[model samples]
Target: MLNRDWHKTYRMPEHPTLDQRVDWHLAHAIACGCREMPDTIKREIEKRGLAVPERNRPN
Candidate 1:
């Protein structure tokens, strides 16, 4: 099982921006083995003119 509260353990940047938060979530989600990406991450990616990739699942 994944730890949903993992994000709370980190010290957020002094001026936390949307991109920073999205990066944090993306890292934690990957560490927790989440196959689906969050909406925030998706938005961040699109905002930077990037394409959405397929979800990665562990075997």
Candidate 2:
């Protein structure tokens, strides 16, 4: 479960349900592992201003 308050730290609005956020986060995690993003997924994360933490970046 995600901490609701953590959204503020991520600069993510709480408008979307937690399930929606989790879904996107999971997809993003997969993308990060590959060290590549398709245009569509790239745009989604950019629109949300989500940053891939260094820890999550492909090693």
Of candidate 2, the 10-residue stretch with the lowest lDDT total is 1-10
Give candidate 1 regions above 4 Å deviation.
1-16, 25-35
Best by lDDT: 1
Give me candidate 1's TM-score against the actual structure. Answer: 0.42
lDDT, residue 25, candidate 2 = 63
Q: For each candidate, what is the lDDT?
A: 0.62, 0.48
lDDT of 1 by residue, 1-59 (tens): 33545445654488979878666555654555354676877888888887655544555
- CA displacement after TM-score superposition, residue 24 of candidate 1 (Å): 4.0
Predicted candidate 2 versus true structure: per-residue lDDT over 1-59, tens digit per residue: 13333333344345866546545565545444334444555566566677543324544
